[model samples]
Target chain A: MSEGFGLRSLHPSVLLLYYAGGITFGMLLFHPVLLLSGWAACLIVNGHLDGGREWRSWSLPMLGAFVALILVNPLISHRGRTVLYYMGDIPITLESVVYGATMASSLLGLLTLFVSYRILMTEHKFLFLFARFSPKAALLAMMAAGMVPRLRRRLKELMLVQKTRGIAVSEGTVTQRARNGARLVGALLSWSLEDALQTADSMQARGYGTGTRSSYPAFRFGPRDAWTAGGLFAAAGIAFTLWANGHGYLTIYPRLESFSLSKGDVGALAAYLVFLLMPLGWEWRDRTTWRSLNFGK
Target chain B: MNLLRRKINPKLLVIPIAIIYLVLAYVSLTRGNALLIGIVLVLLSMIPFVWRFERRQRQARELVLIAVMAAVATVSRIPFAALLPNFTPVTFIVILSGVVFGAEAGWMVGAVTGLVSNFFLGQGPWTPWQMFAWGMAGFTAGLFAHRNPSRRRRLPLLLFGAAWGYLYGWILNVTVALDVGVREQTWSSVLAVYSLGLPFETVHAAANVFFLVVFAPSWIKLLERYRRKYGALQRTDSGSADMEGSAHGQRTAAE
Candidate 1:
């Protein structure tokens, strides 16, 4: 509905395919080197999309999670043979430590990809894609999503008015605060339900359930999308086949293998990165076109 | 879209589901791909609920009732967002939705609460997991409420809420544990994930007990009145959100 650029201009299915493939490949490829490279590519793509502001906003929690995984894995699982140190009779293995770091990198890469995902896959695109597959459930999620802002405003109003009646959640003991919070929500619930049923009557008057619902125009599956989807599938197919043959995962247990990429791993890594960053080409193309049309680059 | 309107024979549905699980079983067993398998299973588990809801001929009031309940569940978190991390009336609201509207409506509310809340926040591996977990919490709440006669009873409802507080947390924690990419997962490694989540789950369980103690009676009464006045989700027990969930639950379990 709004003007979009680069990845946002892609069809919703293609966008969905990109994320699904990105996450799947990120999870499947377990080499720390590959994961680190994946993280770099992910961040660069994130920067290309929105200058990485969204990625920056989510950095703290993701970093905390990253560190937690790095610390927790070595402590809990004692499988790896290369024990780096001992903590109270618990042997900290270098293998588990490396495994944890790789996991953390995969996670960081996932969070970065999701930041781009949130930017490109706007709500309208999500609803449009899901609506075909599961109509009522899609409608349910969409309508509920639509109602959140209005309900939020009403809840704020209720909370403000209820503060005058010596009722507020912010300034109470544990039990007291919980009660006041639910009280505000209860009031909000009653108020919203009243208006909601009226809206339902309007929906009924418009013959909502009378026939199969016609939809608004969805984005066309253009030639650009076709080529992108074709390339994505081809690259991913190569990567997945190699991964299935055991090139993607690192050998962590029963003594760790060297992190050097074999020929198969290199091939898999190449295909995977191509699949991961193919959409970046769209951004370069879009930027050059925009610059030629509007201003000097 | 039209496919959902046509009656989907469960026996017919089983063929595709069985094939999917078979393929997934091969992948997970051979490749040790826990993360992808876990995510796929979570996504598949939600289909029956969505399928059940789609096939039913719903009244506008019922649809609106579910949308409003889900919105309320999503927004109910705002009041306490500053007070604690992961503390909110969302679970209670979802449970109440199940208790008042019946299990199917409760499940829809819970699942939609998961979907809508994450859409408002952001999507991650947890989106489908939250949907399944929250949906189960609400499903069980409705199942218990429906089987039992007394609607406003406190002790049973409080225990139910308390159990799901931890159960909900653990359901979400499973994804994280598997997502950690353990090559060969032993029992202790799984235990470590649970141990990591213990504090948050404890607070969550305590919060559920507190909310149930404080607001069950008044909130249930408030919604009960609306269900009667608007005649929303109050048709014969066969076709509405309430009774359909038990049947659906049995089918999902069987699968």
Candidate 2:
């Protein structure tokens, strides 16, 4: 549970918009420069939050797929004209290479953005956003998420106690291990089903469905949140409008365009960066506030 | 206007909007943007179901029962996180949840299990697809179990589980496979993607069959016993479908 500070402290709706816009623009603008820039922004934001710990942890698989997409696009759809080289009979086109890199960057950008999303959008925050519209699902998901740890702990206890009954799943033939795992699960289910129902009864006793449910720790949409949201939408509007005019996308089909950005593309990129990094304004403010309080001149 | 509002379900108004959006997407976006189309369709298909579940008042026991089922499905993955790659008991539990609980509860359990499990594993583009696939598995199980789910019926469930094993793989793989085929407009490209997943699909199917054969009967009996004990979520018996019954307190399922 990473604490909500800086970007995390923002209202959940604002956080949701940040990610939604980040992903939307990432998909909308297929240019390599724009995609790479968005990914870099995500990395900077990730670093600002947790010193890139979470980002680095997820970087390997994301980068692996990132590289895979870049390499595989040229191989799979051999449609472009500029032949770079030949591997056996397969010709690699410059257009395809560019397309691959564009896709790779887009994938990386989206995945990196989600890394920060998972950090910021914890279960409570997610429920906060959804509770009003779908209270039942939100409550159910909340309860289920809450039970996961207890259930896992119980399963661990089951595995240990049942190990004495010659039901060790860790060390045995594949079949034996699989069978033992099943047995442990069966026992766990019976124990949990009985226990969970009791909790349900306790809940009913306490007037579980008595009144309309209220969201806990009700997040207020403060003036700061409004400003952040406004700035975010304004920037997003510009970026989206620019893209709608075909400014941000790098066309690489049957022919390739220069990697250099046009005037409108640069403006689009600026709007995109502003929208992405708006939360960082709060992060910066918080950092300065902390610094001044701790080590003031 | 009030009469018109009552005539048409305001809840389902998003369908035409989604259709128009999809048509616009099909017209404007490239072939590769089908992932977005798929996600829109998935959410559109799910909205009415979710909206209905939301409006319908449920008992504490019913809600908790679904929660426990989802939680268990998620936690069960922990013990086997590194076990045989395709052999997780999640699908087995989900299917049994449907078979015992009926379609709505089954779908919720499966969907919630997918979502909550991803909270631990990782959330990504694939999460929605997984939720839809697994939820449908539970839903179909409920339907398959029919009115009186018999403990003697192992073959049908085993087959269902096995089929979902492949079906699950197909659901996950289809979007990407179609992307490839749609790009090339060739059957070979799609087949290549499908064939690439053959081993995983086979193992998943086999694992589903294996678990259902060994565990389905007892699990079904256990869940049914609990349902009868709780006297919650029996809103309908097999044939009558009393979903909108006013009596929330009584044992609604006919003995």
Candidate 3:
């Protein structure tokens, strides 16, 4: 799974399925808890699916950011009825704390999912998905996405060189730090100008932004893709229906509301569960098929 | 270094810069006021200055250096300012551009930094103001590229930079206040808002002084070294020597 599901190797259809599922889930659910839970599930699954090495590197920072969000958000936005305490003209409240936690969770979930997608989805997949719409735009998007990691690497190299030269920026006075930063910026600008020209030249040589364009063929809507997409659509439909009928949980500010579930809501939720489980099923089947092929070998 | 020495045709930079300017103009004209359009036009005008440098050298190395600087300048401003002191590294960045690549490069750095930084800050009518303020700061810095080095003379340049820093913030505040429909067009109202931004302005000015004091000598040394090692400084022809001598004499007196 680690090798096959790597971002560079993932099929475009698979990426599309993930995006469609996320958007549908986001739109269908309004309850803060459920929305947050959905977001967490996406993040954890995304992180785990990418494998342990990547997860290990990101987990600490992710946790730190989450804690920071929880601690900081409530302090700044102290607005609620249930006052927990008062500190120097500022009033803290239970509602505000909960709201802050929920917001943090939501953001964390989004970040997790985004990071997972970034690590799992490759430029090839992105280009493949959008190839038919606008080839030049798609190519540009691919280039932009690819540029992030490359730019990061370049900056790291520059920082190291600066450090070696005894121009330690982080340890300096505010003014000295600013000067050091300026020197780095000067170097970086000179670097990027050259890159942009090369990129433009390379792109132009290939007839980018021309009237017509060609693409490499890799994406195909197979049975697995069909099954995944169909399940997502069905789940989306049921979720939308539940949302429209006001059957699912709803919460307004300062008031918690949970509508009594009907037989229809139960059915819709059951369908959602099945839709969510479809990917797990695909993973199982693929594993089983591999085992079968290797039997007695 | 090789890239900095290579010659780039000025004409090539013209089309790309013009296209960007026209697009900015169109956006402002359609969605904003004349003030916004005027700001954008001023910012866009900096492109020609950048092109002037490119006309002499089309080296990939120089191009990369400029682009990376622009990106760093853009990224450095991303984090929320409530926690940090201020976002003033950009002024220093502009100065560095002038020191390393000359005036044209400095102007380009400012313009690109403004435009790119706006992407994360939320793009709208205010982008042009940010662009012009930073671009002007860089252009002003570049104007002093040939100034001789003396502590007394440097003091005024530093003060000039500091003043430019505050002036930029004041202009930005006015433009933004107008855009948001605050409608307090009086001097008092403008002062009230601009005064609030004093901390940020002070930080910017201080940053400029800091950057200039620390890096100016090093930059001058680097340029001298480059001229010595690679023989990059153009030899003054006999006819031009007299003109250069007078200019040199004036610079010496100024120092």
Candidate 4:
């Protein structure tokens, strides 16, 4: 869906493994370099996904969240010994601020990665992931995913109709407004419930849950998927090795430790970055090659 | 006290686990490792309890109903956000779902709403916590609602909704703060986070109270009617006999 990582084109199985591994790494690792690399990778993928339009909108909010964390963390946490000045009786320790910054970066990193996931993991992908495990739950998730957007659209229409009738949400006092909102919801509830009953009937008619349900397979494993998966595992293995060995590790508890890079640190960081950027790398290669072939004399 | 009942009230273990975790979280606020572990434990502790419901309700209709409730809860936030800005109808709908559908359905609705809505809000580390917080809200509300189904009163439901507002906020605050890291163990730091969140909590609680006060009766009646007419599964034996009467009751209400 993006110029960066058309991750959706990859087989859902590959995408799933990539995301599960990526998110796990993003969540577990707290190294500043790794976090920053992950965050930057997410932003770039997200930027490409939206064709460079919506990523800016997210940047400001993400920055705001990070800034808010920076301000709040030091105030609540006072563990570090280095006093960086005090606001009233509170000692805003250097370590806590640094820790907060790390957290903010990690948070930002995790959030952006999820944004990429939103782009990469469509409802079909989500359903595909769950379908093998529990067909009923998969069906439910699919219906629920479809229903959210449909219901939201319906609510907007209802609100518009209500507004035309002078019983709109904004036109009343606090209680009146809430009543108006609830009434709208109540109406939707009855309608949707009736609609759902029909669905249940239709599903029963189609013999749902009668036996092992067969799903329409929209994906197949191919050589490209296998190669990409291999690369992902190899990179991830190397990175995990470095991480487990304490390379590129920076501790912020008790006292702030040094973040100086050694040779092994650089290797670990590179391995980690490679693991994170595998999808982006594929997409970039594809785009550049396609562009050159088309424009070449 | 027999530790295990045939019909396990998950709240028995879940509630105590949460309280113990919260206490641990409070005590270890300054220690990053303990705080992190406490937060993860708090999020995970509710799973075994909620898992019981998932296994209990394996029927397609029940599954569809819970999904529908979750979808409705997710979408209901839009109008409220548009109109009230700070207020959300999500918790109200979630609580109502629990009250009408009983604990399992309520728990499912709550957890699913958190996940489905995060598709719009953008998922983060906070998602599991949201799922846990909302799931518990539905669990307890359903518990209360199940205990006294015949009396669908206003005050108690309203009070429960209001209480959940603050409780949800506190849980959410702790989750986010822990995610963000609260480096000191001091009560003041924890209090500061709570105080900063006071206005939002008040708004959330007020919104819950307001929604329940206004629409809970009608929604409950509507869902009850549907359950009766469609022969939706029930979680309690006490209400089993009332089904036939309510089926006709739904027909008349529709008419």
Indicate which candidate wins on lDDT: 1
Across residues B29-136, which tens digit of lDDT does each residue of candidate 4 receive? 433433245445756665564445434435556767878888988887766765655598889888887787676567778888887788777766677778888888
Candidate 1 lDDT over residue span A154-269, tens digit each: 99999899999989988979667777888898888999999988899999999999998888866877778888999999998899889778787788777889888999999988
Q: What C-alpha RMSD does candidate 4 show over the true interface residues after superposing them?
A: 7.7
Error of 1 at A23 (Å): 1.3
What TM-score does chain B alone reach in each candidate, compared with the true chain B?
Answer: 0.81, 0.83, 0.59, 0.74
Cα-based lDDT at residue B109, candidate 1: 90
Q: Is candidate 3 or 4 superior in lDDT?
A: 4
| lDDT (Cα atoms) of all candidates against the true structure | 0.80, 0.79, 0.53, 0.72
Which sections of candidate 3 miss by over 4 Å? A1-10, A36-40, A47-53, A64-94, A130-174, A191-211, A257-276, B1-255
Better structure of 1 and 3 per DockQ:
1
At residue B192, candidate 1 shows an lDDT of: 75
Residues A128-192 of candidate 3 have per-residue lDDT tens digits of 65544333323433443444446556666776888888664576665456556657654654465
Kept native contacts, as fractions per model, are: 0.77, 0.58, 0.10, 0.49
Ranking by DockQ: 1, 2, 4, 3
Evaluate candidate 2 and give its CAPRI docking class based on DockQ: acceptable
On TM-score, the stronger of 2 and 3 is 2
Ranking by lDDT: 1, 2, 4, 3
Candidate 1 stretches greater than 4 Å from native? B1-29, B178-186, B235-255
Across residues B149-208, which tens digit of lDDT does each residue of candidate 2 receive? 463388887888889998899888765665566666788767766776789988889888
State which docking tier applies to candidate 3.
incorrect
Residue pairs in clash, model 1? none
